[model samples]
Target: MTLLKTPLLDTIREPADVRRLPQEKLAQLAAELRAETIDAVSVTGGHLGAGLGVVELTVALHHVFNTPHDRLIWDVGHQCYPHKILTGRRERIRTLRTGGGLSGFTNRAESEYDPFGAGHSSTSISAGLGMAVARDLGGGERNVVAVIGDGAMSAGMAYEAMNNAGAMDSRLIVILNDNDMSIAPPTGAMSAYLARLISGQTYRSLREIGKQIAGHLPKFVERGAQRAEEFARGFWTGGTLFEELGFYYVGPIDGHNLDHLLPVLKNVRDAKTGPILVHVVTQKGKGYGPAEQSADKYHGVVKFDVVTGAQVKAKSNAPSYTRVFAESLISEARRDPKIVAITAAMPSGTGIDLFGQAYPDRTFDVGIAEQHAVTFAGGLAAEGFKPFCALYSTFLQRAYDQVIHDVALQGLPVRFIVDRAGLVGADGATHAGAYDLAYLGCLPGMVLMSPADEAELMHMIATAVAYDDGPSAVRFPRGEGVGVERPDRAEALPIGKGRMVRGTGEGDVAILSLGTRLAAALEAAERLEAAGFAVTVADARFAKPIDRDLALKLASGHSALVTVEEGSIGGFGSQVLQFLTDEGVLDRGTVKVRSMVLPDIYIDHDTQARQIAEAGLDANAIVAKVEGLLGKAKAGRELSRAG
Candidate 1:
């Protein structure tokens, strides 16, 4: 791959450098920065389209504002690659999403420029408002700007923060990056001129002077003047909603034009308005031909050919857990017309796109609102329709209240197909599906399950659909499954029952596994057997209402018991220990018990194999654990003989 020359970008070391450059050179700098961003993401596959769209906007913001001092927050942070390059991180830009490298999103610890960390969307307004209030209380004057995508506005949190900020009249600047042409109409020279004119100090000062004079006049006349001013501007600029919320609204200006951005931003910075919103219109994948042609296809990519725009994907022997779930649901929906699918602004991520292709009328994409998605599922369930709420495990945390209050508490038969159940490779700790087991298992009457492979995933889906008594969830990991033969026809398994995968007879040690960790447990069992220690491997299919018979039998029959799961501490293993203690299985101290789960610390982004090994949930880790346990047991026997 030929490296693109960044003669202009190579000169800058910080935002101050960007600010010092001549305004004529800034357009060239933006072009260089855009090329650099593309090259970096091509090396380390990550969010491409978002960063490309905001290249000029990023350069303009840094050039106009004194960053690290002036607070600049990027909502969702996927678009921060360009921002990162300007903020002393250009050297490490190529290492994005890899271990010990720059994060895919804005991180506070990563740099001073990233004042607030973000992985989720629709949070910048709230964080920016808090920073703005803090600056006011400290009697300091630092501009607070939040750049949020139009898609993020679909979430309720953005509006909630906007309402509060509007009421408080805090000096906050919100830049709505409208890339999809959804929020507002197209931008032109007229809109750009109006934005510059309205945002200028002169216009704002005159408006404020008119407000004071109106206050002194008759109440009816003052109201009429205010209405007339709003009507005139709102008719042309379409900013009445923001004006009504107590913010001075500007733009729908061209985000790609540095000329327009620099002047308008300078005006807003100088103005003393309490809260202001700037609407900047730009295209996703603005400069790149491949990305511009199909923005969504290139939104997130693997290591791709920079020129050809062809992504390189690893060949997989088995299908992805996501695909299996989508297919299973599609098959079941065919037979059961009542079955419907729902996603929270992630139709493709949650595999709802495939289902939508099959059954468009039955599939619903509820836009970045997880809380609403859960309750909406509950409403459907109440009406005798089976709603399969498909969401990633990490995202499910956002709708816990709805899950409990509306679905679980009322015993609504909402089947939650929780995708990405374990450590996600490149996305890191923020996206890891590590807490779903702990969170969902504790709920009363919630039937929570995890699949061991692609085959089990199908059965679990079938089981979730069949079990209509209450809310049930099945979490499976990201990436391809363990190449197991999928069932010809998936059949629903009996609830709360475990099947022995290996070693039915009595053994020196027993391994009880849940979820995809079953594969590791079986491998460890083989090693244990080879080392002359009898080992039993059992797959506990359900986390909640664990198979008590299997738990008790394993505890009593083996000298040592080890539980494995790809989740946090207080999950499947915790439930098993609690059940054993209540059953008087642990009172005698005859059996040694150990629960293996993810480490307490958050594991950074790396390959999933490395992450599991680091968490001590891999086969080698399991084998070492068994050897240590059996060694202690043998020593105890020796002490007994000696005594």
Candidate 2:
């Protein structure tokens, strides 16, 4: 209950309360809201910079429009923390991103104010257009506003939605929250004044007349008129790009100013003709001193000191998996000049930033556009260069088509380094890398490997670089390594082969682990041995192109074989099952097989250990499955004796 003195914000329970106040008080409300947001996130440790950027914009939207009725769709939802506070969740603002607390992103079920849940980027325009279309079909006359970021705008989906919305002539409001990816300072008072001037009644009337004239005129005449309009808008407001896309482009206004936001938003809300884009320029970290000074550092923060605005960094004993990947890539690049790295707007997250330092020319940050990054890497691979397309497993879903058609189908030698390949805490299901195993494993000519540890990851990276036959991928989970000493030089491993961690024992139980779950598998083996049954543990290095020889051997040596992976169903386990069936191993009748994968349900934000335990892939769960199999064998022996 760390309460801040938010006198203006304390009076508000919902956005309706915000509207009830006079226009003069709205500015004060915005200031108070910003302070309250800072205080709340200082306690909760969620997204701060984005919410701070949109303080006045949030205030203006709620003030000008009748929300809930006027569907305000927030794309990507990271900026919705302030929106949540204004829309009746202020009391729970401090509980953000915690277990059983308010989500980091918006959820429809969480509140009516949140019209649509957002996690994946560049979806707001499409969803807002849909809402507008739905409204046209007897829903209501309410306005639909979609607030999207500059980083999100880099995604092609946003352009697609705008193109469609323009053609459909849907009455939708798209607010391009131009934080500029924290690259430069936001728009100043001149831009704000220009926005206000264009949103006036005279400009609206003239624009309507010009549109009518262009519609009736000949093709040549219409082209001339359209060019004139584009030139006029572009020269005045710098919006030729949006004008061509069919949206009535309106601003590059300062988003932090309530005066600029209120007038333009009110005008757009009142005047309805076609799709409108309000290009509001906002700083990522607008008000707070620490945030404004270092937007990226404060963009996503840990719990920190409020007065000094210093963040708490917990010291770790081991290096993060990201650093290991970066260092390994650098080592590989030093020897091979043909190797290159690509990231989709997550240089730091993918460890490509570190790679960029050593080999700046070889590193390409494609900027928030995953689909382009994949195909771009595919193009690079086609030219006989080793192109590593490093993306988070969840984000890679955006570029699945490119992986299949452009890379795999074409038999290009693209290397995919799928990072954060397991349930991630705090960010929850939205960013979890749970399904890459199933998705990428099924593709033809795709070589899929999962590293058992950091050292294994280095080895896998080398393997991917060495393999020039077709596309190769290595999925590794989030967080630090298991304290394994990394090799100075990584050697390539044989494709489709697995190594035995524990030698085969006399007992009828075996555990085969995939990815980083090898440690758990070994622990389970130890527990089984302690329980009077000898057990063996093996690491299946590759999910696709599985080690058929090793698999068959494991199956033959044991009466029961259990496969474990930190992935959803129909992945490594399914592949193993299919292979065993094809080989007639299941028909032997003496052996039983069980697969332990993540549950069918989407596990939410929790510690990785807890998530593994809940999915029944932990050491205890493995031991239980083994004991059950052993008991079944004992029962069968008694039945055979009776016979």
Candidate 3:
């Protein structure tokens, strides 16, 4: 007779259910939990590998600790999917990361269980510390646990929090999930040190025996046993990184084995002393074969075939803009020895992987520290090196103060290769690079340029590197170029210059395009041309310096001017409008000026083309607006002709 399948997980609507389960059945419950996590992520399509890796840890945490009351803060919270599933979000898991769906990261707005919201890395420990301190001041007896990965631990903020927590001696738990990687392979001295610390055989042996002894020790003997335990901890834990920082260090334990994890977690839960750190060793893609082997690929994936683990790749006829930037940087670096590359934990994403492979000595992966990366580049530039600080437009926000104080203040020539400058599809608003233009434009002594296509981007990169006076930025979009043929040799374009893409007669409408949005403007102009309206297109390569000559010429020549950019309203268009007003060009005539840009609201993830259309920055939208403006122009002319 077949035994009935256990309904253990289905009944686990709350932590009470988990707490009720016998210690012997936790392993089976963990199995069911893993299956549920996999199945949930398979449908929802978000942060699969991280959530899968933490299934058992999540189960053990909720089972052992009282959550919502006992705070569990997840750093860089993309790994909190399983936590969300366990905390009454199982049914709504299908909506993850969608416009109205559950958030990809832990959101305090989403649940009481999520004590703090996190998207970027290295914040959990700090947040957890705040909760712990608050709980103490209020005289609440609740545990505070922060689960951070080894990748996130490389970030300086993690250590900053650790340093602060060590001094406070507050009762807290810091779980370091060491799987030997972040988004890419982990970098820096901290990762290397942690790796060596965890791998020591003597430390492991001493840790196991200490935990066994600590579990049996009476409360009265605990204080007296501490002195003896210190010697045992030093023997087992080696350097005592956390201990020195004022934490009771535990583990480097097998995170997968329930038998091993449960006992350690239970012991740590009972400990009422200072901050404790449990170093858990778990594989990223624990059970899934393909994900287990290549964790990064599965880290954040699109919809994929479950059986083969194959993603249906988008058919792009042209190479991605990132590929172009990588190729262009490599070509430039080959010619100039002074040219160095820097990325803040994004070697592959920013296309610096190629440069790192070619010139490993010159390339630097600063590790999830954008602030450090920018300042480091500034330091390099002060030493007469042309440092290209390649970073995503969104991530660059974190280093604004550094960019201004460190680079722009000194007028250092730090070449910022700003990738994903527009609406990045699927990653949504949090990852969108829309605000860089506005922020970068406002900085004093900063020069900003955006390319219309890959070939222009290559020239812009050369221009940024060659310039020696102040910080220069070259912003480009997320996807492939418009299939334009790239030039073989790299050449520097003149700084603070704009180029005309299409010429037109007097009284014609002038379209000033910035960045990759030039393609859409060109298409709009073509449609306007067909309707017997003269249309001129100008690529405003420079945004900050404001190509005065081009703006003056276009204002004098055209009856109507429209500025188009794949950025916020206060970006290229605002600069152009300010120029027109300052030059007394707007006063000369009734020059009907219009600005086309991304809307003021946060746009959701979809195809780039769809996002453009939704924001009314698409080809058809531009054409319609221009045509309407021309109709008014013709009507005014008719009144003049009739008079």
Candidate 4:
């Protein structure tokens, strides 16, 4: 009853430690693990419900299989908190998702237990297959399990992996955690059918009886019983989809029951056949009252009161960027009947929920299928509908090919409202939108723009709607917008133009900035001004076209030019540098050039400011780097005068 005080959990410093415990104590251990997970997430403010749902499953998997050698690949990895706690990270659980702390998702660098790192969904099967192939090539005997959610199963990549795994006859185990929900309520027919199949009590019981009966038969009888067993399985499991894909379909079993999970996993482990998919039914938030009642609210929470299950709200002067985008999109949809919205299972997260509510008939919630969402939007665009494909910058990576082939190549006017455009906090590197600007800009006829503030974002949105040429993207950051008063009328901004935020005349250093990080660059320029260096700051609205005239004019007049953006080195800054190179300004003039960008490595979860600081994109860091460049420029001038 006293789950938290159990000796089994207290003694567990690592998975190896748990392996030493008696099998009889595992149930108590599972209870203690769940309690620890709940307590840890209460302080750390991370994904709670999914982790709570997988406590028993996590324990059973680790107990039955030899990890660090056998390899367990967790899909999406948001549900890996219980997995993390069980795998030697128990003591550090309080530091989850914070700066310089434990990551919220599974990181291969974080632990040997995490064989394959994942933040995106529907990658487990592919990763597991890779490990299986590698193990087979090495003549090694090890079980490879890929635990993916039913939500993740909707993605085309999951089927691609299943199709390949079926053909290879690779010994891979894919666990489908059918909770019937991703972030919000599940979408599409696949989700509905999976929910019905897994929740059927009669089907599950009959399958178990059939397995038991098959086990009692003689070896010769069992050999001849293949067709009969397949028929029985087909009738009971009702998994023609996975069966057709070449996987041995099993279960619809209760995932929370360790007694059932352990035995089932053991039998599957010993089967020694082709790919096997075990469908496990689990509640999103199993035991905890608050989490179980509202799984979505608890999915990714802030620090909350453990007793009341209420989050501590942080006061914000302005609405979040997501909220603003949602409001603007909804308003635009109301005005324009031809306007519609789409999201890849991130309705609430991307603020498409508002558009969905306003235009219920027009909005589409494509479950965890970014690639499909992109192509679908293209189809909608071809039909004379203005479709806004709202997706997180990170998730947009899934649909790069579609963006090029379907949207860009054909020059379809699809508006891509890219949310969480910069360094996304808490979710860490796996969810950072550091590469979108660079990647999107590279596409021919694609228009890429980042807003400096909330008002600018609204303007960009209007501009995206007005532009009926090719694919256009308006990227905005995560969290609350800067407290700038939003304009009542959304106006279309001039395409391929830059805005001068500070300084009128030519200066020693011209700072060209992109995105919300422009605010930081302006502050840095102010500091440089106090130090007697006149710095001109410009917000480069369009990253693709590069605003060559503005950049050339600014660079031509300034003694030195410095480009700044929150994205990676190959982003907006790179565009400016490339322009300067193409214009032959570098060879013709004595202008010292410097670029400020995010570090190449993946940053961990923290506040956006902290992540920016770590990446050396903070105001102080920018100021120091610029001052050094200016000092060098002056030194060269002094040397030339002396000569």
Instruction: Estimate TM-scores for all models.
Output: 0.97, 0.95, 0.86, 0.90
Cα displacement (Å) at residue 182, model 3: 12
Tens-digit lDDT string for candidate 2 (372-474): 9999999999888999999999999999998999999999999999999988878888999999999999998999999988899999999998999999999
Top-TM-score structure, candidate number: 1
In model 3, which regions exceed 4 Å deviation? 1-8, 14-16, 40-44, 181-231, 530-532, 624-643
* Candidate ranking (TM-score, best to worst): 1, 2, 4, 3
Write one digit per residue (lDDT tens) for candidate 4, span 1-643. Answer: 2235757787877777766777778889989888888888888898999888888899888888888778999999989998888788877889898888898889989999998888999999998999999999999999999999888999999999999999996799988898864222333344434434433444456656766787799877765675676665566566667878988776666777776677678777776677888888788888899999998889889999878899987999999988888888777776788889999999999988887887889989999999999999999999988999999999999899999999999999999989888898889989998889888988889899998888988888888888898889999889998889999979888889988889974978888888887888889887788767778999999898789889988888898888888888788888888889988999986798888888889888898888889999889888888878776344456568899
Model 4 alpha-carbon miss at residue 573, Å: 1.9
Model 4 TM: 0.90
Overlapping backbone residue pairs in candidate 3 total: 0
Error of 3 at 409 (Å): 1.6
Instruction: For candidate 2, give the lDDT of residue 208.
Output: 78
RMSD of each: 2.3, 2.8, 6.3, 5.7
Give Cα-based local distance difference scores for all models: 0.91, 0.88, 0.82, 0.84
In model 1, how many backbone clashes occur? 0
- How high a TM-score does candidate 1 get? 0.97
- How would you encode candidate 3's per-residue C-alpha lDDT over 60-145 as one tens digit per residue? 89988998789999988778887887798877877777656788888888899898888788889999899889988999899999
